[model samples]
Target: MKWAIAMVDGILNVLKPSGMTSHDVIGYLRRVLQTKKIGHSGTLDPDAAGVLPVFIGAATRLLEYSGEETKSYRVELRFGVKTDTADDSGNVIETSVVFRPEQEKLVAVLKKFTGPMMQIPPMYSAVRHEGKKLYQLARAGITIERESRPITIYKLDLVYQADDYLVLDIECSKGTFIRTLCEDIAESLGMCGTVSFLLRTRSGKFVLNDAKTLEEISKAPFDHILPIEGAVEHFPELMLTDKQALRISQGVVTSISGVAEGKYRLKTASGLFIGIGSANNGMVKADKVINPFTQM
Candidate 1:
């Protein structure tokens, strides 16, 4: 039996395996679904694994509206060693004789990293310096000063600690690098460290339990496609009349009443999720619409 090749719309809670880049999953799905209009909400390093929400077809337009900006990870930091990449994957730049801190001290240090703090993006990250990616420069043996950005570690709990390594469950805002966080935490405890392992457990609504493996997706791909509206389920909704929906779909800012000034998930009277729109001063304008060409 051959699966129909068509324009596939919606999201995929892909459980990325280690050793595969997020782009690799998008590339694979493009072949499996036979379409080029695919994108991902976030990029996971090739050595990291776990939930990667993929957008397909018209859903690609809703990527920016996804509430999955905050992410959670199960990470491991191995002490006594420092790596150029801040992870075990990089060359060992420094090593030292070290001792693990007491659980109380460790917990207190973790607390310091919680809430909001400034973080310097790692040299191996995709952050751009000038016109080139930092990682690109790192590959060519160049390192430049990078401004620290504010990031919030909503939750940081120590799951376990051994003689030389510790496991942590971290929930943080976007742009928070676990590798850098690991190093910083170790530094506060008077030791050098590197992220030895990473497993993303959550990306906002997408969780590990709901994520589908590549094998599972290959067998029944459509079954794993999450509805595009799920991407913005956190947003408020506005029910529209047929005429109003038609007007909004045509890029017109339709008049609205009693709806506070904010973004909304727009639905027609028939309950079709058309797209996302913003409201202001008694008017709502469609910011993203389901492009008709993507309909299968």
Candidate 2:
């Protein structure tokens, strides 16, 4: 038997389809599952697709601890055109002579963007200014100065190139905007550019290969709700005795030895996931405790 969405507590690796906004996915899940506690670790644009990690019920509280600070994408950039929103979905604001950079030039430009760099979030983004989202201001024809923020590009590989389009595989730290990267890269080669297609390949340990589509999940929702522990697999682990587990559950810090100082995935001696714990100065304290009986 399938459990109701209200009773389900875990993470879901959803293969988000293009044309649906991140909010749309959550709204659809809410209607299908008949619950409102669902939330996602990150949001994807309406026209971009790929892995979107969703947390249900108590799992929503574990989002910050998910350790999903890195994101990977496969994006296609089209040169000689610029859009108001920096993507094909927006109005074309400028069109210039078509100019495709040579492979050597493109490779060198990609290298220049690798490592640490500054990126200004697009006007169509959700970055906040003066208590309003940038996109909201953009919709009202209001433009504001945006400060460039530091971002890291771990890798930028040119996958494919044609007459006027090029595909790139990017692995970057959180908060990177592919549209801005496309524009910046093209500008370096003396051309205007915009993103034509984008697909998120990975988010933390969640990958596209393991993600379930909306239809697949709708058919067997419970089968797609993964365990909460899987979301925090990147953190170290600590085993607790029954007594220690009980104490930790009550928000009591327990004294321990031989544990390093840092956050960890707390588990019972019998291998049941408890929650997240912080270890320091020979004491282990619960940061977020999962209700053992409530987990799926």
- Cα error, residue 81 of model 2, in Å, equals 0.9
Q: Which ten residues in a row have the lowest lDDT in candidate 2?
A: 287-296
Write out the backbone clash pairs for model 1: none
Candidate 1 residues 1-296, lDDT tens each?
Answer: 34444556899999999999888998898878877788998788889999999998888888887644689999999999999999878999999778979988988999899999999999999888788989999999998999999999999998998989899999999888899999999999999999989999999789999999999999997988988888888798899887788888888888988889999999876678988889999899988887321221
Model 2 residue runs over 4 Å out of place are: 1-5, 292-296
What are the TM-scores, per candidate, against the unseen true structure?
A: 0.93, 0.93
Worst 10 residues of 1 by lDDT: 287-296
lDDT (C-alpha) at residue 244 in model 1: 80
Off by over 4 Å in 1: 1-6, 291-296
In order, candidate lDDTs are: 0.88, 0.89
